[model samples]
Target: MATPYIRMNGAGNDFVVVNALETAFRPTQEQARTLGNKATGPGFDQIIGIEPSDGADAFMRVWNSDGGMVETCGNALRCVGWLLLQSTGRDAVTIDTLGGLTTARRAGPDQVTVDMGRPRLRWDEIPLAEEMQTYGIELQVGPIDDPVVHTPGAVSMGNPHVVFFTDRLDDGFVRGTGSLIEHHPLFPEGVNVGFAHVLAPDRIRLRVWERGAGLTKACGTGACAALVAATRRGLTGRRATVEVDGGELQIDWDQATDHVLMTGPVETEGTGTLSL
Candidate 1:
């Protein structure tokens, strides 16, 4: 029999979701690669599995386009949240992931909000090769006189990220400099690289180079990282709309709770069965 699955997208970051809780479904690296093949399979940025959880409504297993299982995905979280809300008919849903426990709920018309929890600010938390300033860490690429990219802010939103405050999004910096810094020695664990251009106090234009997935249409965690980094640098206020390649997300870094709240939309393209 074919395996059953649902296809969803948060903004433009798409995913293939499966109900592991009901079917004990698990995709191998080869299987994931096959499914993400755009021309042939059900191409998506990542594959998410919904499994029974001990501490939350469900456990979200995340696999990057490369089929490597990672931790936490904000956009995917919202998609899963909507699923749980529909199935259980609840106002809210808590999801447990390798990164941590997160909760999501309905925000507005066809939109969802997720609490990403406080960020890990220490260099050790980002797990850089050694200790350094999280703000403007001592790392750079290109020539000494004029580096292609330099002085990025670092933070860990479950996983890890390095954000470069650029003047514009339509530049070579995103694709040109992203790959170099993604695997840079500074970040012990690979990282998502973000290029952000603050349009105003309440808005930011951004792009990201995901660690394992390369350039994606949208990156939820990357948006959180950019907002946190912008706040730390006093670029934008605690709340703002982060515009990504795919769409925009409302980000709120609450001072009282010290948690990042991300609100966005999820689109279900529908479901189907695949022989895996």
Candidate 2:
């Protein structure tokens, strides 16, 4: 039998969403990889599973195309929210992930706003091996002497991220630098690496090499993490526009609520069914 699935994109990070609520089959890493293989399978950056929630609104599970289980995915969550609205006919939807509970609201027909919760900045919270107070610390990667770009602001949006600020938006350093930093010893569990260029007090351009997913078109949580890091380092303000390869996202760090809000567009590509 074929299991029905939905294809969607948040910003430009594409995903394959499976409705696990009515299915008994749980996709394994191998299965997910087979489904996400661009050349031979379903083809997607990540595979998302929607299951019934215990106490929260809904339960979500994320799997990278490489077959690694991840804690969260902001963009996919928005797509999940849209699916929930379609199923329940509700404007506001709450979904639970291994990271935590996330709330999403439909702003327009295709626009969704998500409250991704507060960021974790402490070295331990960011889960660094050691303690560091300053936003910019010292670390070395390859032969890039005087790598002044080290010691980035670290944060967790239910996932780990290290953000480095640069002067130019299109600097080619991100691919090489980001690859090395993603596996730096400092992050025992590894981390997603983001290179950002501040275009204005309220705008920034970013590129990301995700921990398990490698480079993606866009990463919603990554944008939030970058904004938080930029604000902490005084590189940008509390709210800003994050331009990723795929599209732009509006991010706001609410002072009163102490949470991060990410607003962006989501598109439904097509729907299909999977056989377990």
* The best candidate in terms of TM-score: 1
Lowest summed-lDDT stretch of 10 residues in model 2? 134-143
On lDDT, the leading prediction is: 1
Off by over 4 Å in 1: none
Question: Residues 1-276, candidate 1, lDDT per residue (tens digit)?
Answer: 788899999989989998888778777988777877776688889889999998999999998878778898999999999999889988899999999999999897779999999988999998799988898888777799997667889989999999998874664657768888888888777899999999998899989988878888899999999999999999999999999878999999999999999999999998987677
**Model 2: per-residue Cα lDDT over 56-170, one tens digit each:** 6789999998888999998998899888877888889999998899999997878899999989878888778888863665565445776547667788999988887875445
146 Cα displacement, candidate 1 (Å): 1.3
Instruction: Estimate TM-scores for all models.
Output: 0.96, 0.94
Q: Number of clashing pairs, model 2?
A: 3
TM-score, structure 1 vs. true? 0.96
CA lDDT, every prediction?
0.89, 0.86
Clashes of each: 0, 3
Could you tell me the lDDT of residue 254 within candidate 2?
98
